[model samples]
Target chain A: MMTYAVECKNISKHFGKTTALSHINLNMEKDKIYGLLGRNGAGKSTLLNIVTAQTFPDDGEVKIFGESPYENGRALRNICIVKENGMFLKDVSVTGALDIASSFYNNWDKKLAERLLIEFQLDKRKTYRNLSLGMKSQLGIIVGLASRAPITIFDEPYIGLDAAGRQLFYDVLIEDYMENPRTIILSTHLIDEVSNLLEDVIILNKGEVMLEGNSEDIKNKAFYIRGTKDRVEKHISGKKVLSKEEFGNTMAVAIFDSISDNEIRAMELDDLAISSIPLQQLFIFLTGGKMIKRGDINE
Target chain B: MNRIKSHLKMHYLNSKKSFVIFWSIMFAISALGILISIYFKSRGYESVIITNSIVAVVIFGAVSGMVCYNETLPYMLNMGITRKDFIFGFAIYNILLSLIMSVIYTLLSIWEWLMYKLLGFNYEHFGQFFSGVKGIFEMTWICFLVTLCATVLFTLIASIYYKKGMMFLFGIGALIMLLMFIPGVTQAVFGFLESLVLSCAGGKGYIMMTLYSLAFFLLCYLIIYPLARTSQIKR
Candidate 1:
């Protein structure tokens, strides 16, 4: 069994009367890139904050390396969070900010920082407040990757980056992860962009773990079967129906779990199509997108 | 040591521009004081000169609060350092900066006093400007302590509250204090503090007060450690 880097047990948090997170339990293994996927208000950020000791849970506890991370300096230095905004002193130049980061993170790799600075095309003399949103995100990516913490979490790492910058960030992240693999939790709404990179995917909905498994296993467990409305409905009658759509005489039913020979043969009817369900569609189904706006209900 | 040096270098470099404006204004004030003393000494005059600790307190408090608010507190959550490390690092940096500012101001005052005597004015007639060495040191130390405590208190408040929450907490705190209209509460609290201060150094009230002042500085930091560790970062 892989050693779990972060273990959370029934974690719940509240800000006054507003519940930010509720009954969240998670076990994250080391050396794997896990995607923390959720819609807006899914409590992904709150979970990350609690595990990183930035926020305290009202009930339940979190452990990093089998120890409570609260006020634990030894544990904290091994965790790095690259938030969306990439906070830094407004007056401090890029070089100055990097210098501060280096001093603070004992694991900081100067060479990696230098290379990333050049790759990201961020000016060393530009003050942090003056940098464009894309550049700010890039700076955070550099710090997160270069910190080389045992547990590295990035919350929406590519929010403002253009296509090229996003590509650069993803490419660099993959290359670095391969060279020095660590426990990486990437929280993002851009699921498709990072689909191929994730070894495991955890979908959070309403502050609860809606679905989690190996990426391939998760894909194999659900499939899209399309045919005549009656035929598709008969085929998905017993299996768990994740989602369904109908147009004219044709229908598509997303069935969870393995489809049997009879179900597969049901698609042999004329004008029928059977294909693998895309992860995004599964995410949408699991997150309750049909009934309400996904990521809207704050769990 | 290296980390401390790097932070200092960064702080100095980032603050150099503001320091230039501040020192210029300070120089002008020193020059004006010297000229005033010289003109007065021409006739018979004697009066005590006092440094405005309030101005120094505000400057130091604002600078400390702003710097920590911008850089230190926000990053502490993501960094590997614990709250102890963060508070200690901030305390060291604050103390170093306060020492530099106080020393510079003291030197300027001394320079003004010397200039007054050198401009053909009688030293005794110029008034007792120095207030002796111990007095100057005590005043500087007191100013540093006040600024340090006030800044830490501000940071603690900021750390625990932000935007809407900040206003709410402040409003609530003020409301509670206002509602506590009972007589002698203020006196009781002050008396308790005064007794604690006296006990720290065997009833040498002045010395104990100095030590308690230092303790208050540390106490503010201790109070904020848990706050920084558990506080959430607002978007």
Candidate 2:
């Protein structure tokens, strides 16, 4: 039997009458990166909070290394979640915060902390309140990477990082993750930028798990086909059509369903174009399908 | 217990600077007051250094406890400190802080009393509530209990606010007014609670007061743990 780094069963949460998550079951393996993609109010942060034991779910259990984290200090030592908002002591300096984190987490890496300190150009005495938003994000990224916990989570960790700084974060994350394999979950709105880094994907839509599987498999589950209206309609028959558009007699339709290569060949879109969708596009379609076509993106 | 100690260490390290700053200011004022007292005595005038440093210490201790619970809670929980550990650790520090400060004030008061003997300068202390060397232990225990009570009360209030925000106080206020109205109308329970408070305040009820304060302290912890257990960190 394989022990998961993080696992949840029948996880559900509610805020007043608003259901934040419902009957969501997920298992994240060790030494892999997962992209939790969702639109605004899609419950990504709520789910992450539950997994880290920062927030309790209304109905379910979350286990880190096969142990419930609630009041389980030994078990929780394996998890570190850096939120988008502040997590550091507001009055504590950069070094002070690191000292606090190092004391709490058993697997803290001083060398990694020092390297990130230099990488981010962080002054030792600059308190959390003194740092700009980008600096705060950098500090959080540094903590998430340096703690070297078995399960590390970053919820929209790039709140104010510049494009370059964000790239640096991605580089540091991948480099450190490669050196020391651990489960890492990055919940963010930057779908395109993190799509490549994700080994598996869990897409949430309105407090529900809409899609979750291997990243490549999720991307392969959807394909775009273009042809005249009659041909497009016939090809999409008895298939789950994700989105469609018609211009004059020509029509382009995106289908989101399991279709093997042989099955695609059977459809035989003669005098038509067929292509697989990018992960970001597929995510957009899966989440809302509001931006189904390239022309629809601008709106 | 080890976890609680580790959490206590974290809380201390995180707030050491603030602690130092607060105590430094308190002592600076106390020293300045002592200097002026010395000056008066040098001029052959009477000088009495009335040091209520116990009150200052208690206030600071309570406020620090409140700030620690309110501000560092999310970070502490995220850092893996349990609610029970946080309460226990914070309570330990508050009690220790109160005792230490109380002892320091007693010693200073003793010094001031010596000044009265040698230089005709006097000092008044809360220690006067008791007599002889026993006053030191008595006042120390009193200060410890008082500060511990205040600390736990503040923590309880912070946890309530954490659970229900400022609106919770309104409900409490409403209940207070309604209970007060019972004297005009009729409510046996309200009268019982009123008598409980009055009995604790009477001069001859030291044991009862200690018991009452301890009960309140335990009640505070009881209310705080559940509130904290369900508290959500608003990110």
Candidate 3:
């Protein structure tokens, strides 16, 4: 039996007639990094909330380490979710917040937390309300990293972080993850930045799973074929077309399907330019967004 | 069990500074009252100094209980603390705080009595609502019960508001208003409340008041436990 770190079965949630999630099922393996990619209102946060047992799903169940997480301390202790905001009280000092977190998370890494505090240049004496948005995000990052839980999740953890800060986070995340392998879920809009770190990618669109598979496989399979209209259409005829854009007589089609080397060569010979779509562009296409063409904009 | 202890420790650490400030302000007020009494005494006039410190303690309990739900619940839930542990740990924290406040009030009452004897100043305490030395025990019991009940009741209200939002509160308000329009309903409600207060005020009714307060606390806990267990941590 394959043991999953986190599993959701037919999970559905609704808020006042708004379907936040609809029968979403996911199984995250242990010791692998996952990218939970989604647009706004795509139910990424709602799904994360349900997985951590912070909120109840209207239908279906969530299991952490093969046990229900709701009110189960044993099951819950293994998971730590750091949201973009409200992780600590306004009055709580940074040090106080860390101390509380250290107590709750059984596998807390105090040394790492202390080092991160100094590295991030966060003032221990400053209360949460006084910290700038970037510093607050840094505090959350520190907690998420130092928690060392079996299942750690970061939901848009880089909200106010600069490029350098985000890079530093990526470095530390990779280094620590290599040393202490655990299930990590990074839910963010910065798909391009974290795409390299993700082993498995799950894209949600409008309360449903639009795509889920190995990152390398998904990226390799997603390709943009651009050429004359007839050549592009004929080349991608049997493929799963994600989106299409036409500029004058030229047509660009994004398709998600395996391409053999011979077929790629044949498409090139037929005057069809084949290029692998970047994860971010592929995400946009998969989530019902059309690529903007220069001709269309000019017209 | 360890989780509960850690939670209690977190509560203590979180509230330690606020508690110090609260006591400092309380003692400052007490000192000012004493100074006024001494001034009146020096002018050959009698002034009675009444210390309603128990009221301050009760208010503290209520406010802290409500704030606990707002501040700690999300933080704990984010940290992966189970709702069961949060509620259990919170209940323990409430009981312990109530006991400590009750003891502190009892000692303050004794100290006030000593001041009355030594300085020839007329000092009355909330504890005096009950009789002499027996009043000490009754006062402690009543104070503990009141503080605990207030804490639990306020926590229940806050939890409901956190879970159900303003609509639930408005519904409750509307229900009360509708009941008030019915004949004898308002009178009956006020009459019941008056009797409940009178029961606590009269020394002989201490046992009854204690029972009523315990029942209230239990009811609040029963409602709050399930509400909290199922409550979502709002982002």
Candidate 4:
């Protein structure tokens, strides 16, 4: 049992009449990359906001580094949250924004900030309002990474990045984590793209913790089966098939359950292509793949 | 203290243009008033200080109110600075700006008086016009009151609006000030409240006002504590 770096016990939040989160219990390990996977309005941002003290949970308590962070400068100093929209002063240049963050965060690494600035190719003189969407996302990633806090949360921090820019972010993030080793929670819909980087995954749906487990365990736990329609249907019947699709005589079924060696061997002779479902597809099946539930699921 | 200093430095760097514009506009208006006084100095003219004082109060209220919200609020919120520190930091900045404005006005008045004297106009009452213990006290009290009022209002509005409060505060304050010129509105409003309070307290003027101020400050603090505490919702 590792000592949890962050914990949310029995946390429930409501906005007006709508419940944003319900009885949410989470324990995050230190120095692990945890992906908070959820659809839009699935309370990912709200949960991040609550955990970072940007928004308070309507009920229950949160602890970061084993202390209540509300108004606790010592605790907050060790935590940083970079929201997707980028909270920055208008008319403040990129350099000015970084200066402000550097001054505020005692652990702020100026060298890292400068390095990221170069990597992002952001002009220091350019004000925040003038930055393009991708540049803004890069700016947020730089801050979130450079703060060097013990706990850092990035809520969809790569909102508008091109492939190369996003790749740079992912690489720098992993490299930095290996050296610095902080508890990082990345909340985003780009599940498959980031699945390889995640050590753990917490899937949230309809304001509840639908699933949480080690990344490898979750991958091993979920599987997909494809074969002739009758054989696939016969094998998947009453086996918690999350979803099934059929085209002519071929059929595909997604099973959110463990498969034994005998079961795989038995299914093999049925001319089927049994494969592991990607994390994104797993999420799509788990959430019923409604447009609202499968937020931004582009390959 | 270091955090505050950093914030102050950031504010100064951010507010360079606005500070210059505000100070220039204030000086320009006061200079115009002094020039008009100089034009009338040959016979008898001593309204420069009074005119400048009036203008100063108006400018201080408007400028302080707007600056209190615009210059300090967003950046403070963004830095996750507590509203208690916010009130403290903003008070420091507002006081400094007020002192600077007062000093500049005094210097400019003296220069205008010298210019009038150089023009061969008898300006024996220049010292009497600009220098008086009573006037100094009055100006100090008014400036302090304006800053306090604006700060309280801004804090309340900030708590209500959260991060977007500053923008809403500026627009609302401007609208309220514009409405102050309406006939009988100011008196009707303040007088009614004052009378209501006086009646409630049964003529306990000093004690009542003191209790009211303490109570109001306490209530404001209670409200701000939650908003400031909200800064760490997810941390």
Q: Give the true-contact fraction for every prediction, in order.
A: 0.69, 0.67, 0.83, 0.37
TM agreement with the true structure for every prediction: 0.81, 0.85, 0.91, 0.77
Clashing pairs in 1: A77-B80
Cα deviation in Å at residue B12, candidate 4?
A: 3.4
What TM-score, to 2 decimals, does candidate 2 have? Answer: 0.85
lDDT of all predictions, in order shown?
A: 0.73, 0.79, 0.85, 0.71
Model 4 misplacement above 4 A: A289-299, B27-94, B100-145, B148-152, B160-235
lDDT of 3 at B12: 82
Top-down TM-score ranking: 3, 2, 1, 4
A126-221 per-residue lDDT for model 3 (tens digits): 988899999999999999999999999999998889998899899999999999999999999999999999999988888887778799998989
Candidate numbers sorted by lDDT from highest down: 3, 2, 1, 4
What's model 2's overall lDDT? 0.79
- DockQ for each candidate? 0.47, 0.57, 0.73, 0.32
Q: Least accurate stretch of 10 residues (summed lDDT) in model 1 chain A? A: A290-299
lDDT (0-100) at residue A209 of candidate 1?
A: 75
- The per-prediction CA RMSD against the true structure, in angstroms, equals 5.3, 4.8, 4.2, 6.8
Residues B51-132, candidate 2: write the lDDT tens digits: 6456676777788777888887787787777766766776677666666666766665566556545655565664343333
Query: Alpha carbon lDDT of residue A249, candidate 4?
Result: 90
Query: Deviation in angstroms for B219 in model 3?
Result: 2.1
What tens-digit string does per-residue lDDT give for candidate 4 at A154-241?
8898888998998998999999999999999999988888999999999888888888889988888678888799999877776766
Query: Which parts of model 3 have CA positions greater than 4 angstroms off?
Result: A228-230, A246-251, A270-272, A288-299, B107-118, B126-137, B184-205
